[model samples]
Target chain A: MKHLTTKDLMTAGIFSALYFLAIGLVTFICMFTLPVLGNFLLPAVAALTTGSIYFLLLKQVPKFGAITIFSLVMGTFLLLSGHFPLAIIANLGFSGLADWFTYRTTFQTKHKSLLGYILFSYGLTGPLLPLWFMKQQYIDNLTSRGKTATYISGMFQYVTPTFFILLMFFILIGAILGGIYGQKLVAKHFGQTSSKQISDLYD
Target chain B: MINIQIKCLLLFITHIFLFIPFHPVQQTVLVGLLLSILFLEKERKRSLLYGSIYLVLLGILIALPYFKSFLGHSFGQLAMVFLLLYPCFLAGSLLIRTSLLSDWILLLKKCRLPMYLILPITVMFRFIPHFKEDFKHTFRLQKMRVPHSSLFKRLERTLIVLLHAAIQSSQELTMAALAKGINQLETRPVSKLTSLTFLDYLVATSSLGLIVWRSFL
Candidate 1:
């Protein structure tokens, strides 16, 4: 339990894939189905759906570096799949912070883990940051890809400061809701409500 | 068939190419070139599917104004991004569909990543297909039990079962890998027994050539 065992890494990988699929499904559906609300709904929906998977991973591994490894794989996948490279940086920052936060509680308390999930959920905003922060590059990219000026303008129509603030708010609400649901799911299904239960099963 | 390294190289090049401000015609050519490579590799079905999707999206973009009143411009914007990302999507599909765990392990080992990182990544890739199947099975089972349930309820139950199955299988998979001495200190480095074929060489050269050409454009 001190270091990441091969088994721990393997479990992390398996769950990372699951987590990615959950997030990917939500994002893809939102992006295509509700073009207008897609950007705003994506992070919130992703955070909402992925909480159970994330909680399960924590319950299984419950060690340092588990969250880090999970997020690293996700960030790398996003980058390879054409997300802005800053996605990786944001992922590392948030996941590291989440890992540290969980470690501070020694993975014992539920409150700290919920806080960690809230922080980790902010990482979802990384991919969309380029829309606001690097507006020119984003425009140039669309224009280069042969988008019409109308299309580009339409894309930016929702990228206002208000929307950005709203996006963060959605992320926070989603994280809180998802974290509570996730805790309930873990406590019900795994029967391990406390760190002592997790340690006894794994360590 | 192309090796994992070549597939990864193409994927990497495609990612970079996505951001490059190439002329519209040149960008289309690059996508066609990559599709041709997929065709060469005998993935004609997927290549054609991707090719048709690209054309359909392009058609939609061209006819943007007609749909604008109802669908709004966001539809066109999404179509544009998808159109541009078509080739990248194709390259990624090829990589994911074709690669094996041994190939990834060999490649990651060549890059000298630690065992922990390598093991997880490999397992992730390996588990994806299995998880998909498990998800389908669980969804069907949940639907049978609660035939009148709401979609959200069915999905939630399915996911719960899916996660439980995944955690259970992870324990089994770890034991299987460990029994095979995956974590042994004295294990030999994975050797490449298959040499690069002529097609592999041609694909590599043409992919690199496309990247270089796109960069200058």
Candidate 2:
């Protein structure tokens, strides 16, 4: 296994911030759009933004544990926020698994890398899974607040495991599309020149 | 204002207990923290105003569904989670804003963590400002497109260029830090300002007691 250089570590840190910025932007935009559709739309949009930026970032620094470290940091921040933090473990698990596949290619091939990214993106949806598992708590909170059964039912549609799984599937599809699109963006604009630049970044 | 170490401990236990159905204790901690923050009044005016707006919104959410059955379902559900998360979010913001990255680095070092782990985290803190500045240029790069290129091509090129500049800046930063001996753990001064006080112990004891009381399930 090739050890990551100091430069690799630094670049990974920068990309971590970059990924968060993109995700935060998407969250704000989706949050402000409309209520129900916004909640449904958030995952798909987040998958695209984070996935593409992550691919571009991975291209810049092709190392083994980059995904692991980045996901861990993001997860830590999530945990600190007192939200559904178990997703951090989910992220670490999936990203570590993806890193295994990427190591098979030694972070060389784009298709294999994209495959890893798609698997890795599943972790982003992990935080939202509480809506399914914590259904009773969520419903109780709403019901206590005088939310009607019909209103609760509307909310329930979005919280169902079936619906959550569907959203995850949609996110998976977006990540796949975004990964392919990111590669194309690279090939079209920067191409071989950036590969040399990427190598230079390692120094 | 709490010290960093206790704040960390408070954050940890609070985060853990917050999820495990400790309504009475949780609400007290959350409301206390929220009010203290609001009273501090740095962003107090906004907090006050937003507080009213949020309450009104919550009321609207609870009431709106009774009248318009079709519209309230998903929105009410979403609002419930939002309200539940709001206080915790405020507490988190307070902890994060109060705690510096260097403070975390020192705490990690005191815990006998490695240089490799510490370096990346510190550099992550360092990079936030640069990323914020460069993020603005991404839009500018989009507007300053190639004359003959189509819109899609210009957009693609902008992403490539923006990332290129970012990666380059990171490389430069690493080199600068490296030259300054950032890789040497001995060189960076870890603050000895903190020792676990009574509050830290109290926080730990409370969390452990709570966990045991809940039967550790």
Candidate 3:
């Protein structure tokens, strides 16, 4: 595989920053809105937020390792941000999967990029792993601490295995929608920018 | 002087410690460390910002027992929300805020990283400031376009110009780095990691001990 240049790598960094910023925004909004909507809708919103950055990055530089690098950086930061290893590892793994999609095949067009983005979206479920794997342990931890039975059972709406499965499905739908939205923005805005840059270079 | 390799290792190990299962005591230790680091940095403005965050998180964690009655099921959830990020919040922020890209590359070299990985990271680091400059130009040109009261139109134009400018700069940046023969170097200069300091030893020992404790103890 051809190596990435300084600019290509920098672009990835910038996009990585931008992508995580979107994630922060999505997470914040979800947290505030949690009172209105249950925690169930979070995976979907989180998935959609990833779309803009993936689309823009793919459109600008569809290089082989871009997605992988972005994913690694993002996962690293997420772990640093106090996320669990299970989810962070899952994010990297899914991102690796997304990288395979682009690297194994050409990623020059919207459709190819969208496919990669969709695969990458599966990683958004990383945040949900705590609920998935720790449901029993978490409940036990709370219960042993003297939390009431009613309180522990009340969490069923969100922490149940069924809800977790549905959350993944919702995440998939949100990611697909995000991909479409990002592609549309690219077609509208970025298509105009490509030619403009050539003119700027000449001047 | 402390070694970049150690710094990188410490940073990574610290992050892993944040992930230890059944780790409340360690998390509390990390939170204390984070607060100390922030205060040591002494950026007055950021002090309030990060300080408030830690305080709020501390409050939530402390209030867990008291709030459990009212917050009910959500109390556990909310307490968890705070608990999860308690350890790494300061560490991640400090690492990103404190280190430069060159520092990371130097550490990578010290670790004997491949040129393929090194080349991109160096460039990615260079990209942020360069893009920031490019965006400023786009914003300026956008302002010129909105000579009158056409604020909305100007905003749209500015955004378009910004995207064009971003794409253009990225291409230019690639060409420049490539032309500099970033990838052609056969070997990187060997890095000498000097002695670890007291603070470094403390971090290393504590993190190592914590890992062992979390894993097997």
Instruction: Return the top candidate by lDDT.
Output: 1
Docking quality class, candidate 3: acceptable
Candidate 1 has a DockQ of 0.49
For residues A123-200, write the lDDT of model 3, one tens digit per residue. 767766766675675665455445678756765455666756777778778888988976776777666565465646
lDDT of each: 0.77, 0.66, 0.62
- Among the numbered candidates, top DockQ falls to 1
Off-target runs (Cα >4 Å) in candidate 1 are: A28-36, A80-86, A105-108, A142-155, A193-203, B65-71
Query: For each predicted model, how many residue pairs clash, with residues at least 3 apart or on different chains?
Result: 0, 1, 1
List ranges where model 2 is wrong by over 4 Å: A105-108, A140-158, A195-203, B22-29, B38-57, B64-70, B110-116, B140-158, B186-188, B195-217
Q: Go through the candidates in order and give each one's DockQ.
A: 0.49, 0.49, 0.33
Error of 1 at B58 (Å): 1.8
User: What is the C-alpha lDDT profile of model 3 across B1-217, one tens digit per residue?
Assistant: 2344444554566656534445565556656655665556554466467767766755765555454343454655755654564555556556555665656666556667566556555554555565556556766777776667375465346545545555665566567656766555445353444567787676667656766776763
lDDT by residue for model 2 over A69-168, one digit each (tens)? 7777677666665556677878889888888788665656877888898878877767666777777777666554555797667667645567666887
Give one digit per residue, the lDDT tens place, for model 2 in B1-217: 3566656565565565546554434444454555455445365765666467567655856465464453565566566666666655655665666667767676667657556556666776676666666766765666665466675565455555557766776778788978987777656665466766675576557645655765542
Q: How well is candidate 2 docked (DockQ)?
A: 0.49
| Model 1 residue A28 lDDT score | 76
True contacts kept of each: 0.53, 0.47, 0.24
